[model samples]
Target: MTLTQSRRSGGRAARHALRSAPLAENVRPVRGGMTGGTLKALSDDEVLRIHKAALTVLDEIGLADAPPSGIEIMVNAGARLGDDGRLRFSPALVEDMLGKAARNITLYGREPAHDLNLSENRVHYGTAGAAVNMVDAEGRNYRHSTLQDLYDAARIADRLDNIHFLQRPMVARDLPDNLELDLNTLYACGTGTTKHIGTSITEPANAQACLDLAYAMAGGEDAFRARPFVSNSNCFVVPPLKFATESCQVMEACIRGGMPVLLLSAGMAGATAPATLAGAVVQAVAECLAGIVYVNAIQPGHPAIFGTWPFVVDLRTGAMSIGSGEQALLTAGCAQMHQFYGLPGGAAAGASDSKLPDMQAGWEQMCSNVMAGLSGLNMVYEAAGMHASLLGFCHESLILGDDIIGQALRCLKGIEVTDETLAIEAMREVCMGGPGHYLGVGETLARMETDYVYPFHGDRTSPKEWEENDKPDLIAGARARKEAILAMPCRAALNPALDREIRARFPIKL
Candidate 1:
């Protein structure tokens, strides 16, 4: 077998072993049980249907100006690229790529035990990356993120059950070297949290370094071989939608290494793309298809995630706005399109252009997150405090986002068909003036734990009690909560020497 095929076989074997293994002592089953939800997880038939839709759209609508390599491959495979640079593919071509695509992935963390399953219906959240500032203890925004800021962020996210993965934002401005900055930040996050660490391979050298770190943390080449790390690699396909060499290289590396790559495209409608929402989405899909083609070319069965963050440009101001309804619709539509390919879909949700925590922020976040969740996205990024595209980050915003996600989770909670939930017998009991008996029952209490997410900051008490407690604002409560979390000791295990090395590599100047 070829190297790629061999790796695929090995991955399948590893996954089987994981499924059969007894649950680890620390590993807890997802609360509220893993079954039943409004988002009836995609089945084989649903996946096939989505794939057919995507193919129809690609062939009928067509795409424009993909990379030469990607275009050449599609043309050779009987696809068509017009003189205007529009590339069109038949349903057969799309089917061939889907048949050879890898649909499931497991992401490894510094702690061998820390991992996540990326499957058709699974959903995971990570903090927004590339943000420049974070709200500090005094409620004042700072200019740059220090190593301390990054570590503290990870610790806070680790304590919250809502955040499934930790991502590296921009490195501290004080760091002299970019390579060391990226590596050190990842090492710190890996050593600081039991949650999986998410990294982006923006450059070829950084991609290699990420692999090396994974190898070291995994205990050697063999362990790394057994469990692969996950990362997202993106490319900028300006206006007409096209890929670049660097983007192609990163995809190829992920395919060769058996890593799960999230192929993300960020397009601003009316500016970098067509002036219409549908036009932007069409161009976005074209760009993603180009990346997928490159991945399939390198390793036919390589694992990947289809991601998009297409935003609309305000016609009056000429600025890209994340708060528009167009943003939410684009995310939902993209999820539908990716489903058509029989691949896991990723999208940005719970984000706003508001610079502060306010009504606009809340509405924008709720709408976007609910849309993505209902649309059946497998993963959602920026599910936290991210303001002004990539400017402000706040603890209160994060807390609010968590509450919004709780509501989204509730929406996904499919109705239970159990005899008790259906309550045919219970209705009769109530009719007989029996008080229904469920309010005081043990089952009700058991269900509450999974059914409801208690708010960390929002007032749940009576008005009198809330007033007596000084009527604290959400921001104050969130700040206090963050402090408490940072004080708690982390359970993550890292080699003493390696920990020292990472610390020494990135020290706090102050």
Candidate 2:
């Protein structure tokens, strides 16, 4: 398999596409180079207003349910206990802590090519969820997700060019033990792909065990620290402004254990947060800002991604409208707030509430995916391979999402109207001095691979040509492609000794 392909271990058909498929570099958008934010969902003044409202929430309303040590950490970091005993922060305190937080973070992969620089509106899309069900696209049914499902998803994500990172997208429902599930999730993801992975720990001890496994893989603690491939996706807050005590403990341990953290504040709008989109954005921003203060208080300048993932709810039905227009606005607005602070941040995008990967999924996933990338969000989670309003994951849908995200990034890339690109000379050559067509021109051929992004499974044949080719089906194509990827031998793997060591150290169900 190519270095860019997601390498799966031990199988046939693993190398089937290696010789036939185009290189991932031929089409993948340049990292840290896309600039799509040509539209604004909220104006500068409106953004500032929301910012102040978030500050007011932290300044007056404060937050509840901080663990004893967490309370101490914040109290020492310019926070005060209010009359109601919740930790409160002044505007001055919030601003001061913002400066101490890391402005740029490099989420590294096992390979250098996969490293992502989270700065300057650089957008990266990846997987994130804890979907308990796996939607069988072929059978049109749902079943509990398993460890094998997670590994296969990782392998598929590894091969997808637009999928920038791999977070734990589905839960291993077969494993009932919390600690075992956590460790195996880490093991499965780490072995399944070399890309940067984001996952959560159910408890602090589980996080330590995962770290030990990582240290072994990297050869030492400092080695893992220097290029940490795994990050803790910690939901540090339960919305309406309260700390999740156990998750906070997991965050602290992961922080001290040399793992980076995505401090997630996913407030469901009209439910946990305010009903209005702006209010939801404000609440999310406040929670993440508090997260920043907490991270810096623990270790000044330590890497923390300010994750303000707020979802929209169709209050009429109270169902999460993740695929709706409101979700797009919420994602874009949250990205703007992240930009305001000049901190690396994350938000949810490209998620579909559709039960199947159909036209509905296409619109729902692309609308927010485009907006998030256009807004230049540093890290966009749940950008691929999710369905049923985040309750299920479909591999075929995830494969299709790679094509969708590529187009979204292309839009973010925008049009560069340089003298060469303006093509005045080429136009003149074709219009008057030449054959009056650009199709066969050298420039046209040269730019075909660079200027236009092609799809792995998209069908573009004419009706007659399609009939001649037996009418290629997109879902079937996705399924065939998935099978080919899973058939390949696992290229991204732990050393034999290390693999044995890890299995011996822990109960690795995989």
Top lDDT hit? 2
lDDT of each prediction vs. the true structure? 0.65, 0.89
Q: Per-residue lDDT for 127-148 in model 1, tens only?
A: 6556777655354555666777
Residue 364 alpha-carbon offset, candidate 1, angstroms: 1.6
lDDT of 2 by residue, 196-269 (tens): 99888998768778888888777789999999999999999999899999999999998898999999999999
Off by over 4 Å in 2: 1-33
Give per-residue lDDT, candidate 2, residue 229.
93
> Candidate 2 — which pairs collide?
8-489, 8-490, 9-490, 10-490, 12-487, 14-487, 14-488
TM-scores of all candidate predictions against the true structure = 0.80, 0.94
Root-mean-square deviation of each candidate, in angstroms?
Answer: 11.7, 5.8
Pick the TM-score winner.
Answer: 2
Backbone collisions counted per model: 4, 7
